[model samples]
Target: ASPADMAHIAAANPAAVQGLLADLEAMAQELLAYRADSSLDTAGATIRAQAARIAELERDAARYRAMRDGLVSGDLENNPIGEAMYELGERVCRERGHDAIPTAAEFDAAIDTAMKQPTCTCPSGDGSLSWPCPQHPPEVT
Candidate 1:
């Protein structure tokens, strides 16, 4: 019950009211002590970390949602340029006509695999590829 209801009951029963008021006072003291002992700084740090992780998870969720929607709707198939490119790549690949067409998953996996590999074959070989080298980019070697 609310404080107002309790107050009314206490007014009608003095002994019972006194006991209830005493209990409330004891509870308030305990709450204050707990508040004083709690570490606000530690709580703030934990809250910040949790918020950052939630934001990162939200971004990953959006990425997966886009991938799922793309697969279900075949938005790539509807684009004329994309369709032409797909047909061109299919023609270039030396596969049998009866072979299965590569899905978006296969294309994504291939691109990811390629991105993880070294780009240049020329081994001046500092374990680093030359960017805009004299033989490469004509403007800024």
Candidate 2:
């Protein structure tokens, strides 16, 4: 383009220029407000803290499902081992901490340490009373 054409495009009434500048300033202010998320600054720390905690919870859940899966597929002789694992997981949560996420190895070690020869009773909540309980009828109870 010619210099003259450029000058013409750049030229404008002083009042119009002021008006345009004011409009742009207003738009910039609006944009700044939007960037801050409305009329004022937001509570970013709280929002992020809660989200981080939720992510931790999700990880904990994945770990828990992994533990439950072990119980679902077991020795086939009986589910006592799995039930013991479940009780162990709950105990770890209560004693160790709610956020505790036990690994399979941790569970395996616990189960191995606590496993007892089947007492011909059941591992249900009330094993002593439910010795011949219908749930897990003993072979020779």
Judging by TM-score against the true structure, name the best candidate. Answer: 1
Q: What is the C-alpha RMSD of each candidate to the true structure, in Å?
A: 12.6, 14.0
- In candidate 2, which residue ranges exceed 4 Å CA deviation? 1-10, 38-141
Candidate 1 weakest ten by summed lDDT: 110-119
TM-score to native of every candidate shown: 0.31, 0.29
Give me candidate 1's TM-score against the actual structure.
Answer: 0.31
- lDDT of model 1 at residue 93? 65
Highest-scoring model, lDDT: 2
Query: In candidate 2, what are the lDDT values of residues 27-85, reduced to their tens digit?
Result: 99999889888433456767788899999777556556655565677754455556667
- Per model, how many backbone clashes are there? 0, 0
Query: What overall lDDT, based on C-alpha atoms, would model 1 receive against the true structure?
Result: 0.60
Stretches > 4 Å off in candidate 1: 1-38, 78-141
On a 0 to 100 scale, what is the lDDT of residue 124 in model 2?
Answer: 51
What are the lDDT scores of the predictions, listed in order? Answer: 0.60, 0.67
